[model samples]
Target: MLTLPGYLVHIRKRGGYRKRFGTRFGRGMDIPVKRAGARRIWIQAVSLGEMLAIEPLLKALASDERIEIYLTVTTSTGYALALEKYSELAVGISYFPIDFYPFSSRVWDRIEPDIAICAETELWPEHTHQAVKRGIPFLLVNGRLSDRSFKRAMKLRGFFRTVLLNTAQVYACSELDRDRYVALGAPSERVVTTGNIKVDVAIEPVLDPVTCSSMRAEMGISDGFLLLGSSTWPGEEEMLIDAFRAVREHDDRARLMIVPRHAERRHEIEAMLRERASDLAFHFKSRGLPERELDILIADTHGELRALTQLADLAFIGKSLPPHTEGQTPVECGVLGKAMVFGSGMSNFRSIREGLLQYGAAREVSDEAEAIATILDLSQDPAKRGKMGEGGKAWHASCKGAVERTVKGVLSWLDR
Candidate 1:
C-alpha cells in the first residue's frame, strides 16, 4: 500500500525528519511515570489548531487533583507549541506515534490511559483498536465532519462505521455535525452537539489605546486601515497581494498584513511580495519591528494570530480562494470582533460559517475582485465595520459554554 510513501511525504513536508523519526515509528517516547492513585488521560491534538482548541478543556481537567494528562501532537509546530504553552499543565508532551501495528500499540502500552480523547477527525484505526482492546473509554471531542471528509466517509462507510463503533462518545460542535456523525454510523444515543469550544478558549486581552498606537507606530503605519490575510495558504498570498494593490489604488491609507498558515513558507511568500509589489515597503515580523515606515507587514510566525488579528481593521479568511478548497478557522476573527470576508470554500467550518453569515458578522466573496471591492467599502465606512465587528463579538459569545459541557461529559465517563 501507499502508507510508507504517504508517511514519508508527510514527514518530509514538515522538515525535521531525523528528530521525529524514532518517536513517530514507536521507538522512543518520554511518557512519564504514572502517579499513584492518579487517573492518567491521553489527549491527541493533530496540529496547532487542534492544540489551541483544547486549551480550555486541558485547564478544566488540570484543575482536578485526581487526574493527570499526557498530551501528544502530530506536527513539529504543534509539539513546539505544546512545550511552550503546556509545559507546566501537562505531565508529558511528545510526538504522536504513527498509527500502525507496533507504533500505536507501543505508545498505548506506555501511557495506559484510563481515558483517551481524540480531537476533530483523528480516528486512527490502530489507535482506536488499542483503546478498545484495553476497555478504555475513547471519546471524540470538538468533532466535525467537513464536506470533503463527509464525502470520503460516505465512500468508505463500512470501514468508518467500524471506527465510530469504538468511540464512547462523539462531542460534536453543532447539530449538523451530530447528524452527520449519526448518519455515518455513530450510535445516535452516544452522539451529542456540544457547541464549539474555540468560542470558550480565552481571547487575547484588549490592548489600551496608547499601547495600540505604539504598536501601530512600530509597524510603520500612521493612520492607515489594515487589511489582514489570516492563516493564508498557497496561492492566497498572491491573491491578497494583488487585492492589496487594487485597494491601495483607491485608498493610499490602506496597509496589508499576511500571517501565512505555515511559517516555513516565508521565503516563498517573500519572493511573491517582492515580485508583485516592488514599490511597497514590507517587513517580516521574524526580523523584529521595522526600523522605518512600511506599507506591509509579513507575520511569518506561530501562536501570534489572535494578537495580530487585534490590530486589523479588516480580515480575509485564507485557503478559500481558487485552487484551494477547505478554509481556515474564522473563529479568531469572530472573537476579536473584526470585520471579515471569505470565499466559497468554507465547507470545513460550514456550521460556524452559516452562524457568522446569519448574524451579519461576515461577508462571503465569490472571487478576488469581489473581495477587493468589499475591503475598500468596509475600509471607507468605519460605522459599518464597527457594526459587523460587534455582531461577530456577539455571535462568538452565544457559542460559549461548550468547554464546560465537554468537561462534564468527559469526567462523567471517567468516573463511570
Candidate 2:
C-alpha cells in the first residue's frame, strides 16, 4: 500500500522522502553490518520523547563489551536525535521499516538481532510475528495503554491477543497500564509495572551566574516574570496569549514565551499573534535575543526546550487546554522545579498529573478564565510559587532509580 503511486506522490510532496524511504528500500547502509559471532540487540523507539526516555538504558548497555546495539526510529526527528545524541554508543542507527512483510523481513535479515525490544507502544504486528517465528524474544519496555488507545485496541482484541501472547515480556509504566494490557489479553504473568523511566531524564548542570545573566540581558529583560508556554498545540497558544494579556494588566513586566509542539507551525502562530494582539512586541528565538524588551518570545528552534525551561518563573503546558487535545508531557518542566499549570485534557499523562497535583506541584485549570486567574494568583504569591517549585523538585527526586531498575530487567532477560 505504501508503494502505491498515490501514497508515493503524497509523501514526495511532504518532502524528506529519502530519509523516510531509505531503510525500507534498502538505500542507506551508513552503518556497516555487525561482525560474525557478535551479540547483537535491536532497540526501537518511536520518536524524540521515547528516545530520550531510553537514553540512560542505552548508556548502561554500552558498557558491555559483548553486546552490539542497533537503534531504529520511526520518525525523521527521532532518527536525527538518535544519531545526534547516541551515535557513539549505537553500532547502527536508522529509520525503522514501514512494517510491511517484505520491508520488515529485509531489515530484520540485515540486523539479525539476538533480541528485539520495542520502546513504549510500538507494537508492529508483522515485525513481531517475524521475530516470534525466528524464536527471538520480543519485549515491550515502558509499556502504557491510555483510555483512548485501550478502546481502539479492544475493537481488535482477537488480533492483538494473538500478538500479545506471542510476546515474551512487557514492562509497563504503571500498575494501571499493566492492568489495561492484561485486560486486552496479554498474559498477566508476562507483564510487570516498572514505573516511568522519564523520571530518570538526565538533568543538565545549572548554568553559571555569568551565563544566566548574559542570557537575560540578551533577551532584553532585567527584572520580569517569564511565563513559558511549553510544547503548546494549536488553539492553546491563543488561550495562553489571552491569559498573558490579562496577566500584564496587573504587571506589565510579565512576558510570555511560547514553544509550539511543532517548530514548523511558527509562521501560523506568528500570524495569529499579529492578528489578535499586534500591540504586543514579539520576536523569534532564532533571531538573536531582542535588542529591546519584548512582550512575547517565540522559540522556533529545536533542542532548547530544556534550557528555556530554566528561564521561566512559571510554565503552562500545552495541548491540555483544547478539549480534543490529550496534552504533552510536563515532566521536563516539573523536573526543573518550575511551578506549572495545565488544562483538563491530560489523559495521556494522567498518572503524572495526579502525582503532581497530589504533591501540590502543579495546578489544573478548566478554561481560559481559570487559567488566567491561576496564573495571576501564582504570580502574586511568591511564597506559594516557591512551595510549589520545591514540591516539584522533591517529587522528581523521589521518582528516581526507575532507569536502573529497567536496565536490570532488560539484562535479566538477556541472561536467561
Candidate 3:
C-alpha cells in the first residue's frame, strides 16, 4: 500500500544513499535489529543533545550480551560524534531509512526488532504503525509533551491515540507531561512518569585535559577567557555582548567566548560586532581556519561543543532568546556544572528551567535589559558564580538514573 509520493521519496533516499557507498552507507553505519533473528534494539536519538541522553542508555544496555543496539541519527555531525564518543557501545551508527510504508516496512521486516525504543517524541505513524502490525512492542522513552505539542496532538488526537494502543508503555519525563500525553490519546494506564533522561547524560565532570585541550585548541580558545556563553543564537548575542560589556564595566579582566547556534551565521555575527568590538576574532574549525589572536573569540564550528563547553566558567546556552529557532537550553551546561543563565523564553524548557532555578543552578533573564543586570551582578560576585555551579552540579548528580530507568522500562515493555 505504498503511496506514489512515499515510493518516490524512498527511491530517492535509497539512490542518494547508494551514491555514497562507504562514506555513509559503509558497514560502520547503524545496524538496528529489524530482522527476526536480530537481537538488535533500535534507539533513535536525533542529535547531539539526544545522543547525550542516549549515551547512558547505551552503556547500561552494553552489559547485556543479548542486546544489540542500533543507534540512528540524521545529521553528519551526530554521526561523527556518536562514532567518536560511543564507538564501543553497541553495533553501528547510520542513516535511518526513509519512513515510507514500503521502506519502513522493509526496514522493520529486515531488522525485526522484538521491541523498539523511540526516544523523546519521534513517533512516525508509518514506523510505529508497522511495528504495531508486526506485533513488535514500541516503547516511548523519556517522553514529554509541551502544551504547544499537546495542542498540536489534539488536532491529530485520533491518529496519536491509535499510535498509543500500539505502544506497550511510555515513561514520560514529567507528571504534567504524562497528563498531556494521556490527554492527547496515549493510554493513561500505560504512561508512567520517570522524569527526564537528560539528567543521566551528565558524566562525573571528567575535567580531562587531553580531550578538552584537543577540542579547545582546535576551536582557537585558550584558558584565558571565561568561556561565558557556549552556544549563542542571533539577537541574544547583542544582548549578551551588551551584558558582557556591562560586565567589563565592572570587571575588565573578564574574557568572554561564545559559539553561535548556526555555522552559516558566523560572518554576520563577526560583522555584527566589527564596528563596536573591532577586536573580536572568528575561527572556523571546518575550513582549517587557524586559531588567531583577538579579544572576542567565536568558536564558529561544529562537533566540538560537547567538549568545548568544558572551558566555561559561566555558560549561557543560546536559543533561549526571543524568536529563537526554539532553543534547547543547553542541557549540556548542567553536565558541565557551569554557572548558567538563560532568557525567560524558556517556556519550552519549563521543567528543567524551573528545576535549575530552584537549585540555584541558573538565573533566567526576561529581556536585554534584565540580561545586562544579571550579568553585571554575577560578574562582580565570584561567590554567586561558584554557588550556582555547585548547586547545578548537585542537582545534576541527583538526577543521574534517568537513562537506567528508561532503558529498563523499554526492555520490560518489549519483554511483555
The model with the greatest TM-score is: 1
Compose the digit string of candidate 3's lDDT tens values, residues 1-416. Answer: 44646644654543333422232222233354344444677777766566766677788886777777777665555665677877787576665555666557666665556777777877767778887898777888888776567778899899888878778788998888888888877778999988787766755457687876565555565544364566677787787777777766655556577777656577787678875576555444555745574345666666656666777667776777667634565567776777887876665577888788888898887676877787778767779988988888877887767776777776676455
Candidate 3 TM-score to native: 0.85
The digit string of per-residue lDDT tens for model 1 on 1-416 reads 24978987987887757765688876777888899999999999999989898999999999999999999998888888899999889999988888887888888988989999999888988888988999999999999988899999999989989999999899998898899999999899999988888777777577766787788888777568889999999888877888787778878888898999999898888888778878889989899978888888889988988888888899999998776778999998898889999998998888889889988899998887888778778878889889999989898888889999999999998789
Model 2 stretches with alpha carbons more than 4 Å out:
2-15, 35-37, 220-222, 287-291
Winner on TM-score between 1 and 2 is: 1
Worst 10 residues of 1 by lDDT: 200-209
Superposition TM-score, candidate 1 onto the true structure: 0.96
| Candidate with best lDDT | 1
Candidate 2 lDDT tens digits, 161-250: 988987889998889999989988999999988888877777676666677667766876545888889898888888888888888888
